[model samples]
Structures are given as C-alpha cells and as structure tokens.
Target: MEIEIFTLCDHAQDFNGKLVIVGTFDSISSSVYPFTHAACSLAGRLRFSEKESGVHEFKIKLIDEEGIELYPAIEGNIDVSKSVANYSTINFAINLGNLEFKKPGKYAIELYIDNEWQKGLPINVIKQ
Candidate 1:
C-alpha cells in the first residue's frame, strides 16, 4: 500500500468520488494553555494491496514536542471488500476536544496502518 496525498485542512468533503479540501495548514496560534482545534480534517488517498479482501486497521495519533501524547490514539477498521480498484479515499474529521499544549512547540500527527507507522504531519504552535 502507498499514500498518494495527505493533508490537514480546515475543511474536507467527499463529493461524488471527489475529495474537496480547503485551508491546508500546519501552524496555529493560541492565547490559552490548552489549545483546542475547533475544527479540522485529515484527507488522503491510499493504494491497497489487491491480494486479499478483508478488514484492516487504520490509526492516528497526536503527540507533543516532549513526546507526550496530546490525546488518545484514534483507530478504526477499514473494510476492503471484493473490489477491482486499487485506490481508496480516506477522510477523518479530527476534533481533539480541547487538547492541552502543556507548552508551545512543535507537535506531530502520526498515521498508522495495520499497526505500522505510515506517515507523520508536523504541526507548530505559537502563543499569542
């Protein structure tokens, strides 16, 4: 399997086989200690192995600069049924529910597939 595109955006939607995304960014500023990302979306395209048709696990995590987890890991099972297509679309609305930054620094959004680390999206935070 391979990833074609991955992004963190202000808005994303699947409109009749189309992926629509807006306001893709990596940095945010906050005036409070616990910074809450009120709304955001993660969207990407993935190519899967055609050898089998079954269920696979997809997980995501948010980690702070200190290596501390900002929130609990999010995971779900992806159903790859009998299909002839090799590519699939994925979209997730990530709402961390008022996550505490602890301190201002760089953070990361990690993606995992089948328990294996796939990719990471770097995030920076600044205090206002």
Candidate 2:
C-alpha cells in the first residue's frame, strides 16, 4: 500500500472516488494557550496493489510535541478489492470538530496501517 495524498484541510470530501480538498494548511495561529479550532478535516488517498488486497486496519492519532494525545485515536478497517489495474485507490476524509490546542508548539498527525506507521503530518500552533 502507498499513500498518494495526506493533508490537513479546512474541508474535504470523497466524491465518487475523487478527493476534493480545500484550504490545506500546516499551521494555526492563536493568541491564547488553549485554542479551539471549530472544524477541519484530515484527508488522504491510499493506493493498494493487487497483492495487498483485503481488510486493512488503520489508525489516526493527534499528538502534541510532548507525545501526549490530544484526542482519542480514530480507528477503522478498509477493504481493498483486486482491480483490473495495477492498483486501487481509496479516498478518505475525516471531519473533526472542536479540536483544542493546549499550547503553542509543534504537533503530529500520525497514520498507521496494519499496525505499521505509514506517515506523520506536522502542524504548528503559534502564539500571536
């Protein structure tokens, strides 16, 4: 399996196998210690080869610089079917609401597939 696209965005959706993403960002600015983002989305597209077809477990986690979890991990299973092409692509968009940042610092959005770490997306919360 391969990650074709992974990002944090203001909005995202999977429209009939197409990924529509808007306002992709990696940083947030705030003037307070604890700031809440009202809404956002974690979007991605994963490609699976014929040999990798089947049920796959996936997890998404948000962790602060100190390695503390900011929220509960999102977990789910994806079923990949064998396609006539060399690979099949899966698009996903996870909507998040009221995401709180306790402090200004760096954070990571991590993705795991089949219990193996796949990618880490860095985000910075800066005090204004």
Candidate 3:
C-alpha cells in the first residue's frame, strides 16, 4: 500500500498560492482502514495547541473496518514547523510494503478539521 498525502491550501486565511503534502504507503495487505486529517495554521500556532510557533501537526489513525489498527508494518510523520514561511507547497510520503496490498477495493479515509469529520480519500488498489 503506497499512500500519498497531498494537502492544497484552498481557502486559508492569508495564504497566497497553496501548500501541498504528499505521503506514500507500501506493503499493505489490509482490506480496510481509517485516516485522519493534517491540521495546519498560518498564525504559527497549532490548532490543538496554544504555543506560538510556525508549526502544525499532521496525524492520522489507520484502522480497518472492524476497528482494528493496521499500521504496524509501516508508519511515518513529518513536521513543517520551522520551514512554514519558505515554501508554499509541501509533500509527504509513506510506504506500507510490510502489510502487502493484495486486492482492489474501497478504502475509507477520514479527514478532520479542528477535531471534526470533514471528508475522506477513497483509494482503489488494483493489481499491476
């Protein structure tokens, strides 16, 4: 399972162009799983924190339909704290080759904003 997370700054408060976050996953064999959104703020403050800093937290809980976590084979996290003022776009990638994705189906991705369910990224894994 190769997962790529690309975040585009659509309607930010004071963003000019946009920001992109890309992530990849490999070796995923799970049928279903859960995912959370990556939070970002322009005020140099975290959405779940009060500390003043140019940083944001990008986190997600990967789980199966039966409420089982399938993130042991592979995992990763990236922090764009200090370099928030340089680039307008960011990319993140993760590989889940340990899990091994075998078939093709509908996967669930839950994106949250300020602790709320916003949307999901449905991925179809086909054999190549």
Q: What is the TM-score of each candidate against the true structure?
A: 0.82, 0.98, 0.35
Per-candidate Cα lDDT values, in order, are 0.76, 0.95, 0.33
Highest-scoring model, TM-score: 2
Q: Kindly indicate the candidate among 1 and 3 with the higher TM-score.
A: 1
lDDT of 1 by residue, 3-99 (tens): 8767888777777757787888998888887766777777776666666457889888889877677777888988866565754444445434445
Alpha-carbon lDDT of model 1? 0.76
lDDT of 3 by residue, 1-128 (tens): 11223222212232342332333332223334332223321111122222323333344444444434445412233343433453323333232223333344444444443354444444444433
- lDDT for residue 101 in candidate 3, whole number 0-100: 33
Against the true structure, what is every candidate's RMSD? 2.3, 0.6, 11.3
How do the candidates rank by TM-score, highest first? 2, 1, 3
lDDT of 1 at 124: 89
Write down the TM-score for model 1. Answer: 0.82
* Poorly placed runs, candidate 1 (over 4 Å): 86-99
After TM-score superposition, what is the CA distance of residue 27 in candidate 2 from its true location, in Å? Answer: 0.3
Candidate 2 lDDT tens digits, 1-128? 88999999999999998899999999999998789999999999999999999999999999999878889999999999999998899999999999999889999999999999999999999999
Q: Which regions of candidate 3 fall more than 4 Å away from where they truly are?
A: 1-53, 72-87, 100-106, 109-119, 124-128
